[model samples]
Target: MPAGTPDILACLKGRFIGIEVKKPKGGIVSPLQKLKIKQIQNAGGIAFVANSLEVVKRELSEHNLI
Candidate 1:
């Protein structure tokens, strides 16, 4: 397993997806989490920080994975 992995992981249409979920208003992303997200993006994957289903959906939509 990769260290500092995001809360959610999946692959859609040959693209990697990583999502870090938090409370709608109070969740904080740690440094390690940021690094993980960056790593995923740098590797040509999609990464997002989401606090709700809506946020996740939006990110997916932006990536055309939904």
Candidate 2:
């Protein structure tokens, strides 16, 4: 995650990407966060909740952003 925020930003060959890292156990996504991610997606950007390296890779790959 980035400083003072729950999100980390990245770029995959110029495409914007945002990651929200969460715990692996019983983690929940808040409504506000969901709205934010939805905005990213609406803008053709990628957004995900990654709890591990594997999850990060999966999300990127799933979005064809990696």
Candidate 3:
């Protein structure tokens, strides 16, 4: 994977998805990670940082992917 690549990458309903997984506690998103997320979003992909399965589900649902 390239620098700052998201932890999970997938294609759901034809949409590109990128998810960065972190611990529920003491998890931080670095500047590079933030930049990558933004880049993915700017390129019309769904990208975010998730600390739990609920967050991942919510994000996917928000994008109508679930």
* Model 3, position 19: C-alpha lDDT score: 94
TM-score of each: 0.91, 0.80, 0.96
Best model per TM-score: 3
Question: Which scores greater on TM-score, model 1 or model 2?
Answer: 1
Cα-based lDDT at residue 57, candidate 2: 87
lDDT of 3 by residue, 1-66 (tens): 998999999998999999999999999999999999999999999999999999998998988878
Clash pairs, candidate 1, are none
Q: Against the correct fold, how does model 3 do in TM-score?
A: 0.96
Q: Write the per-residue lDDT of candidate 1 for residues 28-51, one digit (tens) a residue.
A: 899999999999999999998999
What's the lDDT of the predicted structure labeled candidate 3? Answer: 0.95
lDDT tens digits by residue: candidate 2, 1-66 = 423233788788788888877888877778777777778888998887788899988887887766
> Cα lDDT of all candidates, in order?
0.90, 0.77, 0.95
